[model samples]
Target: MIKRKWSILFLLGLSFASVCQAGGDIDALYSRIAQKDIQALNELKALAKDNNAQALAELGFIYEYGVSVSVDIPQAIKYYEQACDLDGDYGCFNAAYFYEYGIGTQKDITQAKTLAKQLREKINLSNINLDKKVSER
Candidate 1:
């Protein structure tokens, strides 16, 4: 049991480190994009291809607002769904909003509600896990 707990903690630590790394990468990429660094988009795409949840959500935002590319709602929705599937909160929220308002896709209140509920649960679970970890520590 002690070994299992240690393993779980190790995994959690790794996940936290990766999340920090991803956030740092995203910030750097955003800065580069702002400086008109043409390779930034390619790097973001590569990160998305690697199944980085944040990268996928960033792509969704870029496509949704036509930041550097043409506005493509369908593509944005596609990226959002991909990120949502990976448990990205931003992606889930935006996807839910789009579904709720019939922006770019057919209005589906049921799907929106489901997404909202799932997101809430995820947030709750994360909080619970954090509390548990702190107590254990």
Candidate 2:
């Protein structure tokens, strides 16, 4: 059993390494982002998974403020929630703020309050569990 676990870990590690390496001499998708090209931003974002904090945060900002894409507050909140769960400070702030302001989502004082408190007290905040809790209630 232990050997199988090790094998699985090794395979996953190799997969991640290959993904990082296969992107061709390290692409500079950031350049297109800096140039304010929304289509390029979309393509680059597709390359990085939404769960990745950096990607999530960038996506959040882009959607939230219409930087390189259409204004999509809900999409911003979704990405911020993912990023914050991964220890992104900016994500925490953005998610909490958006929740508080009732942007994209119906305003819920309880959720907003809980999120605000979470940001102040938790080092890393992820809203997936919180959303589950709210749904259950």
TM-score list, all predictions: 0.75, 0.58
Candidate 1 lDDT tens digits, 1-137: 99999999999999999889889999789678666676998999899999998999999998898877789998998999898888888888788788777899998777777666666666665543322222232
Cand. 2 TM to true fold: 0.58
Candidate lDDT scores, in order, read: 0.81, 0.69
Task: List pairs with backbone clashes in candidate 1.
Answer: none
Q: Which segments of candidate 2 are over 4 A away from where they belong?
A: 1-31, 34-39, 47-50, 124-137
lDDT of candidate 2 over 89-131, digit per residue (tens): 6787778767666779887657655665565556544543544
Worst 10 residues of 1 by lDDT: 128-137
Instruction: Assess the local accuracy of residue 124 in candidate 1 as a C-alpha lDDT between 0 and 100.
Output: 66
